[model samples]
Target: MNKVILIGRLTKDPELNFAAGSGTAVTRFSLAVTRPFKKDETDFINCIAFGKTGETIAQYLTKGRQLAVTGSIRTGSYDAKDGTKRYTTDVVVDSFEFIGSGNNGGAGRDQNSYNNGYGSSNTGSDYSNSSSNFGGMNFEEDMTPVDDGDMPF
Candidate 1:
């Protein structure tokens, strides 16, 4: 049950690199998420994406672009150059979605269901209004207006 979802703006451009020997793509970036209570306050969250997900994020996303990510929190400690143990915490991205339109910032597009295929599978469970047919079914097509008089609860 160690899952977290965040929707925020990119603080800066993502940094992409490959792991040694394995050559796995690794992208690191920060998200500026506004606090719920304080509209003026924001928290910069560190995020890391691996493999194809990392490459896609680094290539398509840019600074100030709104993004929604689903992942788990990871924490680690390392010896710093100043002879002190430094602790670090980051969100290990499992999947991501392009939120706002354009490279920088703008109004959100109708198709926010764009997934960057990190931990996705062909389970046929995805349902959306987007043009992309990842799942066979589009739940939007089967929707009907609910009447107040039909309430059973």
Candidate 2:
């Protein structure tokens, strides 16, 4: 029952590190989620993803890329060097989806086609040419004859 979903843009490139004992990959980043009603307000959230999810995020995502994350809130406290107890809250990412065009190498391609899981190896391709068709769907073709019975309305 402890789940959180957020859509936002990355504040900077993800920082990838490995656990010293187990060598497990961990990625940390911040997200700037804008308020729905308040145009000038935004919330900065700290997020962390582990294992393969963390690796994937570090490899393909970058600063300014939009993303949707589903995860749970984790809270903890640690003793600082100043001998003060510091409390921390982080979103432990369970899964994530790429939103809009990524800020990485695959430019001029359909951003939605880049959607993938944490373990997926698809790196995506560039489609800079105007004549290129997406998955064989021709935009110029007349398909008015297709039935509209499937419409829920």
lDDT comparing candidate 1 with the true structure = 0.68
Best model per lDDT: 1
Q: Model 1 over residues 1-153: C-alpha lDDT tens digits? A: 778778677877899999999999999999987667675677899999988778878877877776777789999999999999999999998776665454544333434443444445322323234442223433346323223232221
- All candidates: TM-score: 0.72, 0.70
CA RMSD (A), model 2: 11.4
Q: Compared with the true structure, what per-residue lDDT tens digits does model 2 show for residues 18-54?
A: 9999999999998887767675677899999988778
Poorest stretch of ten by lDDT in candidate 1: 144-153
TM-score of 1: 0.72
lDDT values, one for every candidate: 0.68, 0.66
Off by over 4 Å in 1: 102-153
In model 2, which regions exceed 4 Å deviation? 105-153
Residue 34 error for model 2, in Å? 0.5
